[model samples]
Target: MDVYYFTEFPYAEFPESEAEKFPSMRLTFPNTYFDPNKAHDLFKRYLDEYQHAEDVGFDGLMINEHHNTPSCMDVEVNITGGILARTTSKAKILMLGNMLPTSDNPPRLAEEIAMLDVISGGRIVSGFVRGIGIESWANNTNPVYNRERFEECHDLIIKAWTTPGPFRWEGKHYQYRAVNPWMLPIQKPHPPVWVPGTGSPETVEWAAKNRYTYAAFLTPLDVAQGLFARYREYAAADGWEAAPDNFAFMVCCHVNDTEEKAQEAGKAFLWRMNHPLRGPREYWSPPGYTSRAGAAAVAQRRPTPLNELSYEELQSRYHLVVGNPDSVTRQLRHIKDTLGVGALLLEAQGGPLSHHDTMRSLELMGREVIPALKD
Candidate 1:
């Protein structure tokens, strides 16, 4: 199993009457806070912590991309990439990817990533994501066309990385005079590509068809297993014997001497992290957001806006693992045994856990859980 320490770099602020509030703790609340000065130092800590993950023996360190949100730091992948290049060695740097269709120029992404690959001495696990929900609105894209745009963007970027340079290229979403990337990746052909998904049928099918490794983003284990099973079935039918080694699953985790202590810590952090007393009552849906199926499914359960969905609802809808190291390990082992997933994306960030608490969870996993899993 490939162990990874992932960070969300959640924003934090102190209140006179209460503990510091973690911004990325809940999806129900609208981000109504900001401070430019605190951001710099907070980001530095985030980087330090990420580097520490490598020192502690995680096989991989991960960074993701997002924009116009206080939920996560380092909106630009290049900045994160540069920090990782100077920080550590050995651990694969997984940029769970930049949103391709939303990007105006895919070549720029290809070039920058290739450069990072070269600088990192070939430690790059490139992830490709089609921007999610409101991201389409944020990027001024039509969500309906996101899948199509993603496919075209992927093709164009690949050609740019491999083909001889300065070749004219024209595509629906992008047009370029030169088909060559300025910087070629250190890894032959390209860095291994991982695709993160939210259980979309087309995405599952596509990942299987292309033989790309798929990482289940935030779905529950049972659901994740079901989705992987579907992917496995597709792979098998196409003449590939799929095994547990074919997929990756993600889970939120915490650890302590006892389950109660861990739960208390997790709950306390979540409570402190809850920014709003109630949920947002807005469309929250950005234009061109293409989660018609997801939306319909939620509607069947209870008609409500995105922001209004209750905390319990979110947990039920998405399988989020929250428990001590042993409990977490058991759940993961169950997933591996039943679902046949080979790797895990351990989300070092829970909805509202502090840096101290997050590190504790990570350390416990490294010291106790990982060894057991390996056995």
Candidate 2:
């Protein structure tokens, strides 16, 4: 399995308690807490970490974007994707990914990704996402049109990359009279597309229909297994057998030289599991943002929220993994074996995880954990 290193590129210099003053840490939380100076330093440190992860033998580097949130300072993945493309030579740059529904221009989105692929010498895995409900508010996009815009924007971007453009696009959510961009992806058809989901049935079915990899983000192992099984059912109906490469699993992971030290450092993930995830139902799931079926699946999959779970419960559920190299490798391998996924997107760094601990964990993962899994 390909092991990818990931971080939300968090900006957690502020006190976690500040989130209590707002409905959530995401959309409505005031940016008054933001310190440009601290963020400047954090950005440099995080970029350095990304470069180091590549140097230490990670197969890929993953970055994501979110707006108005301290949990993830990266507001634009393409910007960081371009930087990683130039700085790293070998690691696949997985942008999981650009938000489809919130974007107004599909052709521009296509060009930006294509440019990154060219710059990276064809090492880009393009990930498409239907932004969370908070994003719909932040971008002022209608929640009712979330799924419609997501599908239409995706269709247009794919056409921009593959179909010889100069063609016209007339769709419900997107329209372009002349559809051609001078820049095209270095990868032949386009970069490999991956979609991240957490118990969204329509997402799984859509991904399977396109033969795209479906990454289950932070979902329980059993839930991920079920989602993958559904994907297989879809693929089988289409007369193609899905392989491990068609699926990926993402979880927060940390490794150190000793189990005790790893466990202690792993507690840093609690910051992420808590405040940022606390919000009203409307903030997280606007009325039309999710179908009734999707919401039901999500509730069944995660009956207890991560914030409500103790650290031990989190570990037991596989939402977070922390241990010495040997133990981490064993747990990750079990996930790989159980889900039959092609890749593991490990959030090796998360909320308030210090630079020293993050680097040390990355080093240990490269030296011991990753190789052990490969064997």
Candidate 3:
């Protein structure tokens, strides 16, 4: 399995009690708690960690973006991607990824990603996502148009990358008279496109139809299994076969020298499962952001929120893997064998996880856990 390093770049400088003052920690949570100098330091440290992960032998480094929350400091994945492209040499840069629905400029998005692929010497995995419901509120984008915009924006970006330019693009949501980009990806026909989903049938079908990788993010093993099975079924019906490379899994993970030490550090993951995942239902599932079937599937996907699950419960259900090298490797291997995923997107840096702890964990994964998983 290809192990990828990931982090939300969380800012936990403020007291947790402050989040109680708001209905949700997303969208409406005030940024009064933010401090620029601290965030500047964090950005430096986080980028350093990415570089270190590459040096330590991770196969890929994944970056994501979000708005109006301390949950994810990366407000723009492409910006971070550019930084990684220049800084790192070997690891694939997986931006999971551009929020197509919320973007107003598809051509610019295409140009940016193409530039990243070129800068990275073609080691870029382009991921596309329809931003979550809170993104609708954060960007003031109409939720009803979320899927439509996502599809149209995606089409335009792909065309921008693959089709010969200086052409006209007239779509429902985006239009360009001259679709020529000075920059093009080095990868023939464009870089790989991976889509992450969490119990969204439409997403599975869409990704299958286009032969894109479908990554299941933080879903239960059983739920993710069902989702991938659906994707495979779609591929079969289309008279194609889906390989392990067509699937990936994202989960919170950490490792240390000993099980005891690892358990102590693993407590830090609770901070992420807590406030970042906590909020009013409206904040998470705003009207029209998801199709009815998708919404229903989501409701049944997880019996309880990760926030409500105890640490042991989280590990038991495969939502997280926290242990020494041997145990974490065991758990991750089970996930790989159970789901047939080719890549594991490990959120090794999570809420309040100390820098010292994170670096040590990365070191251990590089020296032991990652190699064990490969075996």
TM-score of each: 0.85, 0.99, 0.99
Q: Which residues of candidate 2, in runs, are more than 4 Å off?
A: none
Collision count of model 1 = 4
lDDT of 3 by residue, 1-375 (tens): 799999989998999889888887788889999998999999999998888898888999999999999989999999999999999999999999999999999999999999999999999999999988899989989999999999999999888888987899988898889999989999989999999998888999999999999999999999999999999999999999999999999999999999999999998998888888989887887898889998888898877988899988988888779999999988899999999999999999987899999999999999898888888
Worst 10 residues of 3 by lDDT: 19-28
Model 2, 1-375: lDDT tens per residue? 899999998888888888888888988899899899999999999999999999999999999988888999989999999999999999999999999999999999999999999999999999999988899988989999999999999999999999996999999988899999999999988899999999889999999999999999999898999999999999999999999999999999999889999999999999999988888999989989999999988988889988899999999999999999989999999999999999999998877899999999999999888899999
lDDT value, candidate 1, whole model: 0.70
Candidate 3 overall lDDT versus native: 0.92
Per-residue lDDT over 177-211 for candidate 1, one digit per residue giving the tens place of the 0 to 100 score: 76677799999888887888765767888888877
Which candidate achieves the best lDDT against the true structure? Answer: 2
**Shift in Å, residue 151, candidate 2:** 0.9
Give the clashing residue pairs of candidate 1, or none.
25-351, 143-288, 220-319, 244-340
Reference-based lDDT, residue 222, model 1: 64
